[model samples]
Target: MEWLDWFNDSIAYVEEQLTNEIVLEEAARRAKCSTYHYQRMFSYIAGVTLGEYIRRRKMSLAGVDLQQGQKVIEVAAKYGYESPTAFNRVFKTVHGITPQEAKKDGAKLTSYPMLTFAITVKGVHAVEYQLIEKEAFYVTGLGLALGKDMEENQQKIPEFWNEVAAAGRVQELLPIMDGNSPGVLGINLMTKEVQEKWEYVIGVASKEVPIGFKQYKIPAAKWAVFSGEGPMPYSIQDLAKQVFTEWLPTSGFEYAELPDMEVYLDNNPTDAKFQIWLPVRLKRA
Candidate 1:
């Protein structure tokens, strides 16, 4: 309940600050979380970026202002837009009409109401996971920079792995996996500078990388490792959704700000078991 309370309060704070310049750090502070973790969690649960959500809410309010006979320039400035053209472009994107049209009688303007966080109890699936601690380790292999489009990245990632396997890169890199973690891993490294993209590494745990291979060291930390069975991708993807929506809010843990990991147990992912490891720390008392 405290988790939901904090998150709802954070959303309320964002709504209150919509007319002013919103500082994400302040929003995170109100929620008692790091900006990165806050943004990541918000995107997963709310299905939009924080900036995008704010933009929509602002435009929604602008539509109301226009309907109430407010001038275009005044409404634009009130919502933090520099010029009427810039405001009209975004306003149309949301409401599908210009600000001038919004002022006319019986104009149907879109609305994005204030949001509140809550948990719904219904048909729940069993989630399998364990809390494990590990020492610092390294993964050595090839890496790719993936854009922020999660749907696109999902398709591109499997293709990258397939290419690696087809070219015998797996066998070439398997020898280097003589470290603590078992099997090869798909690592997602979130770049702080670029929130819209992340670095994906297909590698194995190793202390020393082979020549012409990239290596990344994972810091020692506590992890909540989740397991999924059945078919490739679908099962894992379903489990990931459950982790964020069902398990995480009630797990009493916060993200540890480290690269998340996925461990592959079998060479073939078609119908094998795999694990998703999330770096986390127990919530403070």
Candidate 2:
């Protein structure tokens, strides 16, 4: 099956076995992709991490059962929780109430329904892109260790950028170049692990001249570049997500095992434009 079909199949499996213990690794195995890639794709497309979705779905069902006069322990057991206490802890964390309280007061709670996939055909928006084949370029910027939770990383990235700026290292480390493209840049580095660690750089691209800054050489490769005009960081990130979820699977291209780079065209956060370069190789039919 194609990669997009594999992703849809994985989502179907998750929906079918909502009440079962859905291990991420097992889900990735079924999809024939690494856990890191699976989780990243899930979050990019679904707008929520897999673990968060599961917890919300479980809690939503538990809330319904509680309202239906089912015992808390019974609902807990049905959802694969070993004990009511465990269920209660998770429920409180997600819904901000215990099972008993939710049952007695009919408190408001969050729900995460099963996801359904559909393709919508629309008029093409002009996407400014180029297939660039360039020699290796050295990139240097801030590097930090990311935790296992992808959601945590998403929330922390903006702050990380601010911290980099506050330290005044961005000025010294990543100097703006005199070119048509000049602005903040982000470089993501990944490894082969289920909970992969990534380093994000919120700096500008430079051809040369820098010390006390980490350097990474991006090898010569085919790149699909997409540009967007909007607010900084968020717009860049949205484009990245769309590339992984919408472009790669449908474009008949397989992603290369190399770091992706985002170059900020204009660095001002309020009025920013950026471009993303995704490394890919055409799949052999």
Using lDDT, give the best candidate's number. Answer: 1
Which residue pairs does candidate 2 place in steric collision? none
Scanning candidate 2 in windows of ten residues, the lowest lDDT window is: 188-197
Q: What is the TM-score of each candidate against the true structure?
A: 0.77, 0.78
Q: Write the per-residue lDDT of candidate 1 for residues 152-199, one digit (tens) a residue.
A: 565788899889889988789877677556777898776352244578
Off by over 4 Å in 1: 141-175, 179-184, 188-202, 229-237, 264-273
Candidate 2 accuracy as lDDT: 0.72
Clashes of each: 0, 0
Measured by TM-score, how close is model 2 to the native structure?
A: 0.78
Q: TM-score: which candidate is best?
A: 2
lDDT values of the candidates? 0.81, 0.72
| TM-score of predicted structure 1 | 0.77
User: Which portions of model 2 show Cα errors greater than 4 Å?
Assistant: 13-21, 64-97, 104-111, 175-183, 193-197, 202-211
